[model samples]
Target: MAAEANADAVLAELEALSARLTEVEAYLHIEEARGRVTELEEASAAPGFWDDAEAARAYMAELAQVKGDVGLVDRAHERLSDARAALELADEMGQDGAEFIAEAAAAAEELTRAIDEMELSSWFTGEFDHGSAILSIKPGQGGLEAQDWTFMLFKMYMKYFARRGWKVTVNDCPAAEVIGIDRATITVEGKDAFGMLRAEAGVHRLVRISPTDAKKRRQTTFAGVEVIPVLPDDIEIEVAPDDIRVDVYHASGPGGQGVNTTDSAVRVTHIPTGIVVTCQNERSQIQNKAACMQILKARLYELELEKRAETLDEIRGPKTEIGFGNQIRSYVLYPYQMVKDLRSGVETSNVDSVLEDGDLDPFIIGYHRWATEQAE
Candidate 1:
């Protein structure tokens, strides 16, 4: 039955897909990534490559990503070769080769999906859109409930990252005043992490019976989510020493045994913008300071983009621009359990699936499609 599923037509479609894959590889810079992988590998093998541990880690991460990009194209080419061989084998085996034809058809269909996803990359036109992302969530006006909301948002994103098979590091997630976290800082590393997560920027409002509230009354809380690309080494943003204040303190949260004992955590305050960034994830004060500066630069870069953008929404992304009046999405767990995106009008009645299970892809994709249409 599988062999009768137009194996010749499927093979022909796969042949056409081979040409499409080549074009996709060129657009995605697969050859350039292959070269970069070779260069980075040689650099990593050199002596003293790990002298500055943080920079070395960054380089190695880039190396891994470059190799992955190159390997994807390589694997696609291999699949095409395998499909061709299968088709030939099926022809040679006559009626006994149904399984080979079925397998070839399946490979073609899978490769088609992969190529379409890669082609969608063209929608991300921003300079740093393809890079890794820094995720930050800060509580708004909901007080204790807002703090709790902040923690919940952090967990939701963590779950989403896990589902996407992305590597994540908790840069900072200190305990809040009474209930939740002060804020959440996470570094997410994956293919197009910045591009995909930028949809989550801005304000998220949650309405529910506050677990922290004694009255158990319905409460409305807001938390602002910030997403910015992890800048490449070439894109340098300078920070003048005179324009910032540095504070060092004992590292807090779950950073291992001696983390809290030493005053290793570094916090930098950009005096002009009043933007504050903290890094206690690293034990060494210098390393923490470096991480703090990197975060500061990303924030400043975002600020610069905000300056250039005619409308704040263009830079902030498809969501609302981080304010009480401008909540991007609402998660209602009260009288009715519904999660909805205010901008895209994508809504779902099952709040549990969204909040607990991290089923956020529909909303994200919906907004991006809307945004792309608007651009057109």
Candidate 2:
């Protein structure tokens, strides 16, 4: 009787998982993804398809994604079937059903994890969700404390990217006088980098004992994080020469010595919007100008997204403000250690692990689900 009861429980759990898998399949439009995979496969096999290197690479990447999306459901079904078979075989040997029940439980847990990941992927429906991201962190209030906070954020993100197996390139980092960084820009490249990091935008508040203060008082500091998607090569953003000012100067190092002999540093200002972008990391003037233009385009794209969000807000209601004075997350390290996300109500007392060890998935997942719910 005991063996039978365990088997029944395992079967019931497997049944529920099957139902959830069905829902996931429907939500993911598995049939549509399969069709896309077929189309991409046919295109990839066509003659001269590889002639256009960029287009060929994009097609192959899309094909892989579609196949993987479809495979998730397929694999889950296979696991369910295997679990059922194992349970049936164990039932024949009634005395040893517990071992098989354990296997079934493990399989069920795996399926649940896969389903959760699929659900998260479903929330990435934004236009530029799958692209690389350009992220910037700037100090706000609290003087040098804010600068130190900004640098901490920069390191946290770098660690987070490393954990994700993403590549990060520091585009620009200017150190502060006493400690930490004044401003930093980084490029994170990986699958769905922009989609995940976009949730990290806005102000981040930090409350901690000031190391720079003599009295050892708790200080509240603010740092702004901006994440923008790197536009694909196929998308063209037009910026007229008449509407921009271009400045060229020699690139300088930390000690104010000229890093390059020529005037390689380029600063481009969008006259109408008064947005300024500079690129001095590259060696040649042409390269710096190109990099500056790319950053400018990304900024413009972000502005357009904001405008669209505002229009949508007019229809729905007022949403959280995007810029200064609107902090999304707060890290407290003074009396108590806690990291909390204001919008998602997700908080964890493991502040040190979050800041030092780069445990950010919980907050990211919470915010993603919250945003998805709001969108729906």
Candidate 3:
């Protein structure tokens, strides 16, 4: 590859990668990030910094992410400069410099990939987009099939979350009386978890031969996927404690001795907003209530954001819902086998790969790419 390597083309690619890296760095405000890092470091070192656990965590996470971005840009710049110098050196030398040219070509490819990832990260500029997320899945229409479909959707997201290396906490997932689950809510903790998952915040439809049907008839089911960024305790919410209600209930599911015996599950309801959150995964009512509060706060924060901005409609559409004809994506298995994202115009015949193994990058990346164009 070295003997036939076009050094000029390789150099051009490296230059473009370098320019893109600079653009990402600028968009991320690396200089401002460095200043913010210094401020955060000083504050963290002061007395009682860790007194508020959630706020300290948020502050530390931001500092770490900013530092990482700055480091990534710094290394990418060095790689670009080195690759350019290698090409120049190869040009000055004779055929003996072919190896250097080949090395620079490889570096160019690597830098391209790294810069592309950085560019994607730069798109998550929202307040909580870079943070973790609260995700909920509820079966819509189709009765028993809908319940089963809810579990399928939950499994698909579990696979997707595993692929993304996000830590997921199943705050609640109660099985239906006969088939799948009544509802499933999870907390996804990872960098850009909310930003990426928000792509799936809408209705998903699945059509297939119903396993619950004795006649093997085809059935269509719908499930709603809600994604909201995890609200940090530092952010003041619009609700008051007086306007909220808390209830405890015995946890329901296939469980152990202490699990189903007592009222360990907690439900939180915001009266004014009519937002309800439930958590039953923990055996302790207090822990479950905490989880419910976390999810509730996220929902409340999302509601507040809705009133102030229009950009959320890009991800969630205009009053999009979980019902017939409102699906953002469709998975067909009976007449034809395919998984399609209506918003991104991305589809594939590999239904098993999507529903089973969780190959979701195409749809997620495609949605962002499409959204970027619509914005432009």
Candidate 4:
């Protein structure tokens, strides 16, 4: 009976260890190592990528981050491998060894948890997750109430990023006349920023009693969100100056096709790439063109990168609406305060608390699990 007990423990430990190693090797080690190697090779192939000091520094920084992740996962796999070997040795030696049984059992549990964490990290392998993400929010129907709701959505995300220690930068914001934002785009920068925010790249619907309406009617409002990954400057998809058709126009607040004063709005069209970007926030045409060009380069780089990956299914359409009609999440305040993420099917009854300042870790965790299931 004692011999059987020892054998049972040994077998359990070995099984656990084997499972852990398999998870890490399959989920993280192989793919992460391969990705790092590919980046290094591509960086080497691009001659004069280091010509610009700032761009060179950024490129090196990215390479270092990838290398660091690879090294960490490699070391973890090595530890798991060692534990597996130890368990195997104990299994062969028979039930006489108590110390070996205890050591293997403890190591097996540790490896299991570590492997699960690594598997979670592996789902962030999407190329866009490495860079900053651009988030745009626009109001839908319901006049001032819709505008106010848009501002609320903006604040919710900003607060979410703050809780996660992520940096947020507002690129352009058109303030509404009375209450909220007319339209806005912000850049959220941090590790896996795009990955975390990808779940938010759809229409947001809000239901509430409109204070603006004298009849005290419950109104539904829609807000559109767009998320784009910002690319590093070393990306070399060149746009010839002559191939770009430049158009200068006034930057107005909100009217028909043409508005604002000074012809500060600048639009650039790259004929070859069929890419167009416009900037009207800057005061001068030159500054607008420069900003537009910067965004254009990043967008074009993202396009090329997506083409290489052949994974463009996550990107949403230009316009977004809310509720069961066309939205990924719905914020309900009239009937009850709740927020539901459609993709991950994660919902919370405490909408106010979530919007006020929950870390959004639950949503991310849910999304990661869903993505892993899909991949499998």
Candidate 5:
């Protein structure tokens, strides 16, 4: 009787999982995704598909995403069917069905998690959400404290990317005279990197006891995080040669022999917008110049996006003042340890885990849901 009861419970859970999976499939438009996959496959087979490398890459990426989405639903359905069949076989054999019941329960739980992830992914419907991202962090006010805060922010984000299996390359990082960085630029590459990190753009406030101060008093510091999507090759961004200025200088960092000996760093300034980008991470001047250009283009693309949105305040420039209500989130480690996102109303007291360990999924999920609600 207990085995029969356990089997019934497992069957009930499986039914619930199947119903939820059906809903998820409907929401994800699995049929539409499959159709798009078919279309992309046909296009890929055409001889002219590779003529435009940029468009071909975009199509392939889209095809992969759509196929993955459809595949998730199909796999979930198959797992549910297999679990059901196993349970039935055990029952027909007049044997203990506890093992099959446990398997069914585990499969149901896995399906639930998969569906939730799919739902979260569906919120990323932005124009550039599918591409890589250019991220920059700059300190503001609080003197040395702010500089240290900037470095801390940089480390936190690097850890976060590492946890997510994403790749991050530091394009430029200028060290402060004290013990931290003045500003840093990084390019994060991964699936939906832009979509996931775009919400992180804005001012971040930190309150903690000053490690460098002798008074042992609490201090507040600020850092600005800017995230911009890397524009695809198909996007036409025309920057006239006459509208920009380029300068080369000696790279300032511990590197190979020629890094500090010669002028290997490149800085590009857009005359119209007064936006300047520098790249010194690479050893070669040409490589630095190319990296600088990539950053410049990403900035320009962000400006274009802001213009289309008709909201300049939404995407603040690199030099925007960071204070007061400008901060989207705050991390308090002094009087108490708490991290809170104002926009999403998500708050947690696990400041150490968030900062040192880079546990940011809760904040990201909250912000994504908030942004989706705002969009609607």
Candidate 6:
């Protein structure tokens, strides 16, 4: 009876904590500032709204008030998450229900102290992070080896996502002749998928022996990874049919072997932006067309988001630091094995493990902390 009562108490506490956590997550995910901004907008729609000095003052004042409320909610959410994490850890480790309560109490207290030491960092908390992501990997310099390295990277990420139990779907795989990949895009679907992959948006550099060379010399290669948020259907994007040029082609394998007898591949090019998206993964031409259009919309949406940034300096620009010229992270297999994230300056000398299995939590947390510092 005592044990049952203890279990009930713990569950009750957890239920309350979960409710608070959900509230915080909602506030963090959506800009609550939108409400106040909307009010200001509605006020402007009123007759002589802009010209009325008293009305303008009142609207601006209300906007500021809502902004403050939103910030408070965001902070509360971060604290709630930390508390819940501590409680979860304790619950997993405790022997019995009563012990779980005692352990959780201590853990929660410790978390309170830890969180008090610093401000919360959570820049990756956008509506996009809640959805899946599209990761595009393309090889940079170096010869046939570079292409081979890109293929290796493609496999590495696939293995990583597989280990995490995340669903991965390859949309396109443009293969190289001898031994490499020209370009490839993969969709990783899971909870907080974009947040997990946000750190991988930069360049990746690899240094190793060239198997193709008669002389096994050390070679350096680069690959660029572009991570884009997969927008949902609710997020409306207005694109006119006349603005796009759609092409149909028979899909083929690496060596031009016709995989589909019919023209099942669809390529959609945004005429205005010159953004081209191709999809041949689906067996049906109609499905491929839909897939291509989905990617096209995502890319265009990302472009617009970037454009809205305050200045050109805020943008990642043309070059991705992920590769030969620049690198946000590196995986070394020869001479020494190590994995490092340049932005966070975090590293682990377990290249084999990281490549074989994707354990990116450390890197992601580091990047999140770093992003928070930048904002401060």
| Predicted structure with the largest TM-score when compared to the true one | 5
Per-residue C-alpha lDDT of model 1 across residues 45-71, encoded as one tens digit per residue: 999999999889988988986787677
lDDT, candidate 4, 110-146, per-residue tens: 7655555556566777766666777777777667877
Predicted candidate 3 versus true structure: per-residue lDDT over 49-96, tens digit per residue: 999988899889878987898888888888898898898888888677
lDDT of 6 by residue, 1-376 (tens): 6655554565566566556445444544436466656767777678987697866877776666555446555565565555456546545655544555565555444434333222222344466765688888887777677788788888888877886689987887766878887778887887557766776776788877768778888788888888887887668788899999888887765444567788888889999999988878889888887888878888888788767874222223254444454778887776787888888898999776666676666676777677768778
TM-score of predicted structure 6: 0.65
User: Residue 233 lDDT in model 6?
Assistant: 63
Best by lDDT: 3
Residue 136 error, candidate 3, Å: 0.8
| Model 2 TM-score, all chains together | 0.80
Per-candidate TM-score against the hidden true structure: 0.72, 0.80, 0.78, 0.63, 0.82, 0.65
Model 2 per-residue lDDT tens digits across residues 124-224: 87787877988988888888888889889988988899988998866666566777876887888887898888878778999899999899999989888
- Candidate 2 wrong stretches, greater than 4 Å: 1-17, 51-58, 75-111, 246-265, 280-283, 304-325
Pairwise TM-score winner, candidates 2 and 5: 5
Clashing pairs in 1: none
Deviating ranges (above 4 Å) for candidate 4: 1-26, 30-63, 66-118, 238-289, 300-312, 317-324
Residue 250, model 5, lDDT: 77
Candidate 2 yields a Cα-based lDDT of 0.82
Go through the candidates in order and give each one's C-alpha lDDT: 0.83, 0.82, 0.84, 0.71, 0.83, 0.69
